[model samples]
Target: MTDEPLADLALSRSSLDRVALERRRSEVLSELLEDPRTRVAEIRGDRMQVVDPGDRAAPTAPGAPSAAKASGQDASRACSAGALGLVLRAPQPEDRERLVLHLGRDGDGTAYVGVVSPGPHEDPAQPGWLTLRQAGEALTRRDAGLFTTGLALANWHATHRFCPRCGAPTEPTEGGWVRRCEREGSDHYPRTDPAVIMSVVDPDDRLLLGRGAHWPEGRFSVLAGFVEPGESFEAAVAREVAEEVGITIDAARYLGNQPWPFPSSVMIGFAATTRQTELTVDPVEMAEARWVTRGEYRDLLREGTVRTPSGISIAKRIIEHWLGDTVESVTGGTSPRW
Candidate 1:
């Protein structure tokens, strides 16, 4: 396995420069829009349009096991032509008034655009609208960056149409990078909520996993919670672990982070050591909490008694890191029903 840096975590790398200054120029923006080499990732709701290469649009099965697979050739084979399938097309006629985001250039120097289409209807079959969760693992690194950036920007636009300062409707500017309020003259940028997710380990080398109140019975994952207004990531991790499972932890070691913008959140990963092995799971946040040896955890995964976040999620990445190797079923197959 290649030594992948934590920053290169799934949905992390991007070739885009985000050229904020250039986004302010109308002529420059118009030129990019007219460029035939520019590809537009049409984001509607939580899904973005990713051109399929031969295969039909396979929206990830809701309950399918996380699709975390190897990157490079493995990821390429998983999704046909992955990035090659993403063909740039001319903007549709009605897309004129919609938000347009600048995603920057690819390695080949082809510009990428992200078009935001907000409405009541989101048809997965209408074309390339694939959920980030469904298509994320198979996407090439550059494509991951493009798709995720687009989705994040689009999601922010959908929810923040009005200014929080003055309650006035905002107008899209800076190539859809910012929204300007007419009443307050304030510029609103995209918002990303920072959330900390951690793998809590005991002195016995056992890993802590928990089932959320709303999760399925057999599913369990590492403890995670959003960072409050005045809390740091480490503080949030400790507080969340304590509140959810009543476990006091030591220092939080930063692992990595992934952009999880189903509605906008950056999942920061950490490895936290806990002196308290006893679990007092909060019934409101989590249904149960337990510690398991690596072997037991592997067996539970193989037996279909437990499930973690998707392969593309940082949660699974942190878990695999703690296991000292990737955790796969003994059969080397994905459990779609889990």
Candidate 2:
């Protein structure tokens, strides 16, 4: 729980275990989206059907909760009016799997989900109330990001009700995969943005950290920026390092990626080494940059002295790698409060 990104919250399903949208739209529509112990209703707008406290399982059964599908007046509409925007998170592995949800249509007919998974790594309960009376506010950002995938799919149906190129409205086809444009001229589908974040490790195995001027006092995290077109990920990493820290990165290696949905950003993690050079910081990108020692970092984690990224992120991973064994015993193994 070292304020770094903890990406493995939900199991990372491989293609073998994945259920694709185009191929299994029927399975999704027919099967309950949530566990059988919970309730399922149409998730339009940004609301979710909350399970009554009495309906929730006791503390013993941590993962046995089910979502029973509803069929009443409350059945047709999304519960609690949706909160986060639906995101199309598709992992194109050796085999590809995509998840879609219904989102509301913009006035211009564009579909949007309010938030994405790999975003700021904020707390689920951190935002504003959905309904005016605050009667049904139960979705966590973690779950909201998950449920929004479905909501975005829904909104895709309403607005994509046409084709952009031919001015022909599209209809749901292949369960919910392709929206066949009215004229069969050209059908348009949903789109996702690609962004990269890196966790650079120097020759000494110390993580390279930088703090944007706007971040919290004493809080520092990894260097990250969007990947521009026409450049490779390695190039982006080098360019970003140069722009932010004025240093050249040596070897750039891929680690993993997390879905960040503050409007859909994929956090690409990496490990890289930098050549010895004078430290320089870009005022726009970072205020300070340094290679913190393990001993120095241990104090931050144990005493909770330094402001760091929330424990649920990549920055924490880099630091954990930085602190190694010392962090293992911090906080009496209570998941290390980041």
Candidate 3:
């Protein structure tokens, strides 16, 4: 059978094809870098700049219009989502950015990558760094795709600078996609941990949301956990729910997934059904667990007591899907799906 309906999760849409063969050729990557048509998305720390376009939607108060509806700008902005504050015009090689990678080509066949470079921003002013979480929904499909891929590559480069097998530092290779150890002659590719986040529903259709021990007060969303070695995505869903909330999931179905590149992980979303409604929250895993009906979920949102995940997250999408309506997000923005 076909997979369950997918949700409109952020960082899910991409316009690049990641020309793998071209990236393999150092000469080709270098040539592309020098091409005047090529563009770069600059990443500093975890933030990228959203290209500010005239007539673009102005940044609104966090709780103003739904962040989802914040679209409807110039066609150029939509086509070049990468232009969000983070994208840079064509730069000469002298920029000498520390980290760079070949992302892929856009619909117009213009190649784009990410880099650490200078921009129009005057030292953290109006056009400053936008966190990926904050910018994902606001970005064009191309921009979101480029940012997520670039961030994941950049984060890997930052952390995997050392060879694990030998006590030696590795160097970036393969267009910033692989790390090779001089001592061991080993190649390490970027790592993406597979995580499962699920919306668990009981017979009454109440959605299961839990607050992690460290999450802010009243914050709750669906349960999520990393996939263990040798565990399938479906199995991980069942195991995580049981481990976190002591509920036995009777059936699990695949939904969709999004790349959560906060540090490199793909969140596989699922909708699950569980017979056991009783929650025995694991002190080590979560602070509290509750099954909230649609009415109660709306009431909690109305009372400003419950906070859900951001509009861009898969958790928020699944939760909204199950709630059968767009519950006012605590983040004060409309979800991208609506």
Candidate 4:
């Protein structure tokens, strides 16, 4: 593939400056929350509210200044029409009781924080509330980074409420970046599991695709699996291909990586070449496996015989890399949701 494909991976684009040293300041979260200049993104479940960039009052609290006003920019000129931005507001008094994360700072030194609610949004059916999968492709680089980081941290806090060493409850500290054990005094940080997703190719330049054991019939994407203990990404790639499809790859090349926080994982991508062309599918892991040439895959997509992966996924980009054109170019429609 080329650098353009790797650069276009949706979840990999982030412009926030994660001032790590600032996260260490005592009472920093409190200070930022008190400042009206700080920008706060509210997350409920996996969704955050989105607004058209051209809308001036929609993204702010009832009485507070909008993000553009706080940052000294003209809201009308902030972005083109039809583009989306996060609904950031001035922090509320109740935010102190919720899980607040210090996302990062913009280039202008304006702080950004995320406050997560305990349950789903009050009105999920409301027009603007959307999850990362639905909004990531449309959001600005900074908002995308904020949403991705905030959701990943919130997921970690949700599942790691107790200390692994002594079974004690943990409390958030260090701007919600670390959790300290109430009993043992041990500190825990956020966790991200690493998985490898790869496009496997045979000598004939045919791309390998598979449907998961539980996936519906028409949906298919590249094979992916978690990296095991004491294994490199390349080794994981080879093992995943061998275990899932019974093919040994001769070589593997790194393409790129992106955060996939469906639960919690960072997906590393690779392209592998193999000489074997045989049929052996692991029934427990895959429902079906097949090799498709560039022409055949295009026909499958154009005919609506196969569904592509989610638009925000690296799997889609990897498949696009192997196919040498986008699925939309062949199908004349947006990528289908899986």
Candidate 5:
């Protein structure tokens, strides 16, 4: 069905709750897992890369055959979604010479097998790890971004196996969805940190942007920061703009958001309209802040003006929306960006 995601082998995406995923026995899941005709795929970068779903030997990750002895192959592959989690989705080394296997923990506990290999475009793990492009494809090219969701959920669950309140251990349940603390009877749900992603626009329709102190050379993006506890989203927006640029936002227009699963965050997107256009730079937070006119921003985007945020990030979406916003709706009947 064309209902699949953008078919990105490497993009950050959320997961689809397989509502109809019949709860099968471990044997059935195993049997169906490697079936040749199982219309399935693997999540990478937030996108899905199709792999052959047939019961065949897939490719091997860095430590093949003996996944136990691969030097520095101990799980935490590179942290989580955004934290450098390094998970290898290598297939078997024998048989089907062309099939692919995912790097999954086997049932026997003594061996690690490729269990998630599905669809057709899956790589052979010839190099043992997915490349940056492949990672991006997996994150964005797929339908509904599953790779990021799966990996993020899995990573958080893996790291939080212990309870904080009681110092007791927890176990994975509900197909790795729920964590029930054994000692405290506490049920911990997945956590998604809240962040303010705003497009601070001046009356002249120029969008405000800044370069962070630690960003790469010539790299710049919209202002964004995490929202602290007990603070309203709008308050966070006003405070952030003031703190970062010395401007105050009078109104906030809610924009859509994207689930940034890089270790679990829900970016709250907004377009903050401010009449005051004074420049205030926080040496500790940003190197500089500037206002760009609609015409100027158009040129900037056309000529690669400043470093923009990732396409998958809400910051980018908010910017895109304002860039094309109707002149009248953009606060003062003025064009916003150049």
Candidate 6:
């Protein structure tokens, strides 16, 4: 197995400075909004505005040259040929009425904020608006971070408007990072559920793969499950493998992790080894489970028989770690998506 950590897990990349201390200042958001140097990323539903590097039709808001510079748009033409970038503009007056999130700052010290619309204000089928899954692999590192952080914050705020302890309405504070209950004044922060995704290998060097219940045929990826309360990640890995595939893993090694903000999750990855590989599958969680050697896996990809996980997923990176090469390198083409 490769000793090096998995490289370039999508959604894990970020160039932003997160200036977490700035979130504590009461005047920070006001000051940033007053200055046109602050760039605003608007989030509507699960989508954000994305634009091609060469597309000049989307004009920057007034006094936004600094905003554009901070967003790396000036140098984006030299980026990957078909790469997309976030559409950042000067803050609007209505942003104060919406859910405003103090995202972070770029290396240039220019701040970025996210304004969440109550609903999809624009047409969902519009060409420029895209969810993170659709545009993550194509966006620059900074934009990916902005979108992931913004979406996660937005989803949290949407679901957590009321305090659990007092059953009281909460108001956003701490630059939108914390919500305080109106009655009890208790603070609530964003929550990230931890899930373990693993590549389970048997003694013969075969990798275990399973298709989730109700997943389409030919769609398979490694086993994964939420980390139960009071359980370590390694323990969760072993338990999930056993519960899903009826196999007891002897040992599990840390691989890597990535922010998976599909409604809010951080996927912790692992590589597990097992001596027992009996074919007993759980019907509730998984439809099928099988072990495949590297050669067999490659052949399945070449024949388009098995669909891989999403390109922006830690599962894909974990699979590549076990395969010793990218799926594209094996298939010599774009991977068949699940």
* TM-score for predicted model 4 compared with the true structure: 0.92
TM-score of 6: 0.92
Q: Which digits, one per residue and each the tens of the lDDT, describe model 4 over residues 148-211?
A: 8999999899999999999999999888899999998999998899999999999999999999
Deviation of model 1 at 30, angstroms: 2.1
**What are the runs in model 1 whose C-alpha is more than 4 Å off?**
1-7, 52-87, 125-128, 329-331, 336-338
Candidate 5 is scored at a TM of 0.62
The regions of model 2 sitting more than 4 angstroms off are 1-185, 325-329, 332-338
lDDT of 6 by residue, 1-338 (tens): 69788877779888898888889998888888888888999899988878766762444553333212112222222223227778888877877788899989988888999989886455656556777877787678898899999999999999999999989999999899999999999999999999999999999999999999999999999999999999999999988988888889999889889999989999999899999989789999999999999999999999999999977888888898889988888887576785
User: Where is model 5 more than 4 Å wrong at Cα?
Assistant: 1-15, 18-144, 301-305, 325-338
Q: How would you encode candidate 1's per-residue C-alpha lDDT over 215-328 as one tens digit per residue? A: 888788888899999899999998999899888998788887888877789999888898888888899998888899988977887887777677668887787887766655
Tell me the lDDT of candidate 1.
0.73
Q: Which candidate wins on lDDT? A: 6
Q: How should the candidates be ordered by TM-score, best one leading?
A: 6, 4, 1, 3, 5, 2
Clash count in backbone of candidate 4: 0
Off by over 4 Å in 3: 1-4, 55-86, 117-126, 328-338
RMSD of 3: 6.6
Which 10 consecutive positions of candidate 4 have the poorest summed lDDT?
69-78
Q: For each predicted model, how many residue pairs clash, with residues at least 3 apart or on different chains?
A: 2, 55, 11, 0, 55, 0
Residue-by-residue lDDT tens digits, candidate 2, 1-338: 13344444211111121134433354442232222322222232444334332343222222333442222222112233232221122121211122233222323432322221221323324222122112122233334434434444554455566687777767654446457777865656655455667766666667677888887657777888888989888889899988888889887777666544334455676666776546789988787888876766766666765655533345555556556652436644323222
lDDT of 5 at 129: 37
Which ranges in model 4 have alpha carbons more than 4 Å from their true place? 1-5, 59-82, 120-123
- Each prediction's whole-model lDDT (CA): 0.73, 0.48, 0.74, 0.83, 0.52, 0.84
